[model samples]
Target: MLELEFTAEDMARTRFAISPLWEVVAGLRVLLGADEQGLHRRWAEPVRARIAAAKLDLTPLAALVPPPSPSVPGFICPPPTTPWPSLEVELTALRRTPRELLRALSPHARPGVDAILADPDRRLGELADLIEAYWEIAMAPYWPRIRTLLESDILYRARRFAEGGTRLLFDDLDPQLGWDDGTLQIAHRYVRGVHTLAGRGLILVPSAFVWPRVFSTTDPADLPVLRYPPRGIGTLWETRPSPASPALAGVLGRSRARLLTELAAPATTTDLARRTGLTPGGTSQHLTALRASGLVTAHRAGRVVLYARTRVAEELLNGAGA
Candidate 1:
């Protein structure tokens, strides 16, 4: 044994930052006690089974996952795989070796791996790697096909972590970046450590239908703006950018423009659904898609996910329908 030494404080500081998939992976890791050699065999079995059962193509999911990020400091890897799978296998393997492979590649991701391994709460710990790997795989070849689901998973997990009193800052610099509770807990611990670190707050921006009300009336330059008009048909965003600015009168047709017009009043998803004659799920799906695109935001009030048009939505709503 290397006689590993870590303090209670240090141990507590090690937070798991990842997607929900990591929770499952961490759970399985504990369920199977093998070192590196047996990990892939153990995890792949269940994951492959689930995918097979669901009839989901493994390829499209592979492309959207982001690549393994640079390693974090003070991190260490568990034993690594023997003959590591090719990049292709790493990207699309039914199981989690790709994420494990990712942790093996970087120190930051590794410490969380080790923390989960060391944690007594076997079930929750396992998910750490599963989430991390999920994100890593998003950048592989077939990502476009499942990007919506991936984005939803990322948002769902991120909200969970932030709600848990973790700092949970997305790599705002990287729009594609996401962090789960594991990462948020780690970030929280880090933030608490420094006596002088500044506290930050979240900026709640609405999604869909930019309107004048969403902007600060104090400054004209601060007015809500959009790169283009809405252009998709499904609950998911599938439209192309419009050639005109939000000021353009012909951004979208009449009905779609009406959707923006109604969003000036913040309302619950259920309320929006009732008013718009859309199914609850349909409304949520659209709101979630819009949230992902930075056009709208969903807020949790009591039990409802309220949807509001963001500044960009407000901007586009201004003249497009006028």
Candidate 2:
């Protein structure tokens, strides 16, 4: 059992973020059968082939992550501190990790880990390079679907947090998590401790590949993080049936109807473009029309604007069989 006590400052400071780097690390664990719950079996098969075909080197990353260990090195890729960080930004942070933090990996070194710790500077750079390459083969292609699922969870959870404070925030977060008074408890597999957040607060990260288990980091040097599976992982990889009905598509053009349908969960123009295979410019034009017609409203979340369905649009969808 892992328990965390929160101060008032910690509560105010706690925030949500979606990390690309977290997916790369956790996805590898699932692919290699360490954290496998059969949720990602279909994803693992094709990604393994992609890695083999590209001759991607998994030695360094796989060493730090798997074969089911008690803990992973915090410096490998510390949790992202913001809602949206590009993979490149995360890789840069990985390369700049302080040398002293290398102590996290000094225990129970895996095969390739010894050689990596041997030359911290050079080895860390190579590790970052390898992670970037691995991202292209494993994460980039399917990121649209993965990110949409995560963002939707964030939106829903944020609202709950706002409405009911800490209790409602974590009440339904996961079976392994608990909240009472000022403490948050997590039923972690290999981690156990009682930590008081000395005003530094916590970061809640929702990961696609962390299904069936939860991960947390309590190092003082890093903002505390609890990584767990998002709400819709069971169907994350399945193909979604089109939400746009024939009549709706006829009333609006096929593209506009599809754009509005995608907004059932708030998303950005770029996200809609990738998911729907529409050009960015075309998506922007369609979104503009929808906004003008009051079918959708755009609200900014952190660095990006999220488009959500207005009540008018939701009612239309219900009546349209969408």
Candidate 3:
């Protein structure tokens, strides 16, 4: 039972953000044990082999995510505000992790925790190196698709907020989360406390790897961070496409028809490219044609442009199925 007392200002300031580092850290948990992480078992199998083949030291990273404990440190996985935070930016924040914070985490020490506490800077450097290496091998290859899923979730939630305000957005986020009066409550198994935002507000992060459980920062000193698994993660590993309807394909051409169907959800050009097995440039061209025909609509969200099927396109899709 984690109770967050939110002021009106805090509610107004709550915003959605994506974190690459958070994904990397959350992914470590999936790799450490796959039995409980049934949603990510498929992802963990190949990723585990890669980690072993690359000879990456998982001890240090593994130390950060203990087995369902209440002592997990908040500083290690700081909430990231940027949609596409660079590795250097994330590591720099980690390098500046306070000695006291590291000390708090020392009790749950594993193979490399002692070294990190003794020489925070040097050990943090080594840890950052490990994170980068692990990320390159496991996450980078699939990041575009993962990011697209996260971004699509954000887009959906933003619309929800606009339509029904904060309560509706938080209510639908997860069964464990709720907003009543001025408080946001999270029913977590291991974490229980009442925390006031003190006008610091909250950062809602959607994660592709954090399924079946939500994560948050326990330290009062840190920003209020809530990380929930994004919708559509079950299909994150699915790459094979359902064959486009022959009627739709014949009328729109194979590539255009495929792109239209894929736009059932909002997606970036890169995501569309990866999903459709088309190049980004080719995907953009098809999107442009679709937009011109009013079958798709494009909207800019931060640095990325997302395309979704227009109402007209939805009707056409429904009619095609009939």
What's the lDDT for residue 154 in model 3? 95
Ten residues in sequence with the least summed lDDT for candidate 3: 104-113
Please give the RMSD to the true structure for each candidate, in Å. 19.3, 8.0, 8.3
Q: Pick the candidate with the highest TM-score.
A: 2
Tens-place lDDT per residue, model 3, 188-276, is 88789898988888998898877778888745667788899888878877644456789998999899999987765566899999988
Model 2 quality (TM-score): 0.75
Q: What are the TM-scores, per candidate, against the unseen true structure?
A: 0.23, 0.75, 0.73
Point out where model 1 deviates above 4 Å: 1-257
Model 1: ten consecutive residues of lowest lDDT: 224-233
Candidate 1: what lDDT?
0.34
Q: After TM-score superposition, what is the CA distance of residue 98 in candidate 3 from its true location, in Å?
A: 2.7
Q: Write the per-residue lDDT of candidate 2 for residues 1-322, one digit (tens) a residue.
A: 8899999999999999988988888888888786546888767876787688677778778988885676667777687866788888888888887766665554765455666768978998999988887776677556655777788899999999989988999999999999988999998877788998899888899999877888898987678998888998898766444669999999999999998777655567998999899999999999999989988876543345667667677678768987
Candidate 3 clashes: the total is: 0
Q: Residue by residue across 272-308, what tens digits does model 1's lDDT show? A: 6786687878777766766677656554333334455
